[model samples]
Target: MLRPIRALAAAAAALALVCACNSASGGSLPGKPGDAAATRGVSAGSIKVGGIVSMTSASGYSKKDTDLGARARYLRANAEGGINGRTIDYIGAEDDGQDPGKNLAAARKLVQQDKVFAVAPMSSVTFSGADFLEQEKVPTFGWGTLPSFCGPQYIYGFNGCLVPSPGGTLNQTWPEGIGQVLGGAKGKSVAIIANDSDAGKFGIRTFRQGFAGAGFEVAYAKASVPATAVPSDWSAYVKDILASDGGEAPDAVVSVMQTPNNIGLFTALKRAGYRGLLSDPTDYDPALLAKDTTRQALDGVHVLLQFEPFESANPRMDQFKADIKAASGGREVPLNMHMLTGYMSADLFVSIALKAGKDLTVAHFQNAARSFSDTGTLVGDRAEPKGQKESFGCGALVRLKDGAYEVSVPFKCYEPVPFK
Candidate 1:
């Protein structure tokens, strides 16, 4: 979930003194003298980086492979001559356990204790340490589902900020792709549901505008489900959603929640005899197909993705698969979206750091980030500053059918619709 804007504002004000001190240091914090590394986590022989992920969570959701994904990317980078002659000293990852307090504690350990140069592949629902990292001027990379990612100079979202504040544009992938599947959205209707969390609420708000902008009648939009627990019974949500649009099921039901919630809701909906199209941002993981029940629950459901699907024939995807296999010691594992999130997050950070030149520091890194722009990346054409506020405007939709995924709406970039 995204951090609350009010909380971020409050913390920014409270951390003003720390931020000032850190900024004045010019990216050089007190550490070993004559290190010749220019920064805290850098040394003559290596550049140290760490990660934060919700490897264990209360909702049965885990981002464990995110560490593997980052490791894979870093291994490949090191194999390819180690990011300008300095091998990456990846300190593995710290598990936040999906706790806000733990998240902050982990961040503190990485910065204050570990003295790491940067944090990459930070995949967690709660990012309470965001303010601390910002105050310390630490460069962080992760998925931009949180508002903390937006408008933060030190934090970067791999695919750009998915949750932009007022005045920023919204990615039209989900709504536009759904519209294509429904032929046209002229008189069609949609119901958007999410967990009762900041991320879910912001997702509903953004997608409400997105679908409406694409001419679909928004029948129901709510963050009613609990975020911390998966509902065993979805009767209440199903009843309201099924009858949301003028006493009938909407043409499409869009879930902005994660997989567990989706499985319960979709299964209940199917049992309740609602046959409309099912769609969501999560549930793209191939691991979910390991269970017949899980597969059946998600059958014919469209999954939205910000990056190219693993099933794609793109050369970049081929390289990604190779890297994953190499990192896993030739073990073939199910490809999931979390892996991509971690891989892409690390990839962006390394790309910018490399551009920062042989002598790397936070100052150089931020400078490189400000001017960083790359086209034809796994996600999309990426640029800094603007990306700090908005998305790269690229994504695709895939559907699960008969225990396999197929391109329902081919990968493409769409012009973003301004968020109202």
Candidate 2:
């Protein structure tokens, strides 16, 4: 049965979503709220869950879904009975922002210092600290779709949606989609521009392989710049696009760069007056189109799909959305895939943790996670005509419509695109 969703204002909702997860569990567990050795209780005890997010970077401020949203949803979980009587204690979080090394340090601090039972919401740094998590037996989980990191005992990732994310279990969806685009487009040209970072390299290589398999010839592909690299004039970048190496000019340019650079690359494309279809993953926010005076510049540009949009037929998603909106003070809470990923991450983590039972050690949490599926989550319910397994339940491809995404197919799920 659906719980009563009390409507509140955005301020109230923010507060509600950010309540202290580690308070005196079931009366008093002692020490500053998040002491990992929280007292065991009959009905309630604090289950410390650590978080790492990009709080200090551009993505942190601009993206609605960040580590804060993950923590916020866990707070919401705590209000919902503390996950089988274990109140979540989001003891603390560190700001990795966009740095991979920082992510590793934060994860270490959370596990070694905070004594958290589990990590959630795709801490992003898990890839950096995968060894520590597996060695320590700390279960690291997330709504991330990247699959390469989803291995050993230390890592567990949620596909989040049928569509692939920049870094999640389904990161390979771009390559698969490119296959479809190229296989059908006859001899259409394709190009790629991703940073030189671990994720950037992975995204570029994976798609390059997939596109090649699908018989699409690459016109030109280059590592644009790393995330840490400061922005530059980018005139050379534009020249590179027009000069398609040895291959023919592409029918489209696929950029694997993050948002700020994405804007830059597109701006340069327009300045060069080159008219070709541009492609990007779903990482780019539709809202950015609002502020960009270069709106006319992106006409007919395409983006990859991670999952069908939430507005698609999904009773569970619709209800949770309403509940979230009500919790956010009656105003339509910003219900994008990012926030939904946070919610889904929170929900799945809770399910697996409690399913591990009161004897809950990190090992049990890990075991519970491997056996779990999206059978009861909002994403599962929202998916219609389910057919795919590794895919986020079942949903069709999506395209940016009216600056927002809309589903192009209802449940035409292909296999999980291989990013590994």
Give me the candidate number with maximum lDDT: 1
lDDT (Cα, tens digit) per residue for candidate 1, span 315-383? 899989999999999988888998999999999999999998887878778889999999998898999
How many clashes in each structure?
Answer: 0, 17
How does candidate 1 fare on TM-score?
0.93
lDDT of 2 by residue, 204-287 (tens): 655675566555677777766746653668787677777784533466788876566776777788777767767776443455
Best by TM-score: 1
Cα-lDDT of candidate 1: 0.87
TM-score of each: 0.93, 0.74
* Model 2 vs truth, CA RMSD: 10.7
- Scanning candidate 1 in windows of ten residues, the lowest lDDT window is 17-26
Model 2 residue 164 CA deviation in Å:
14
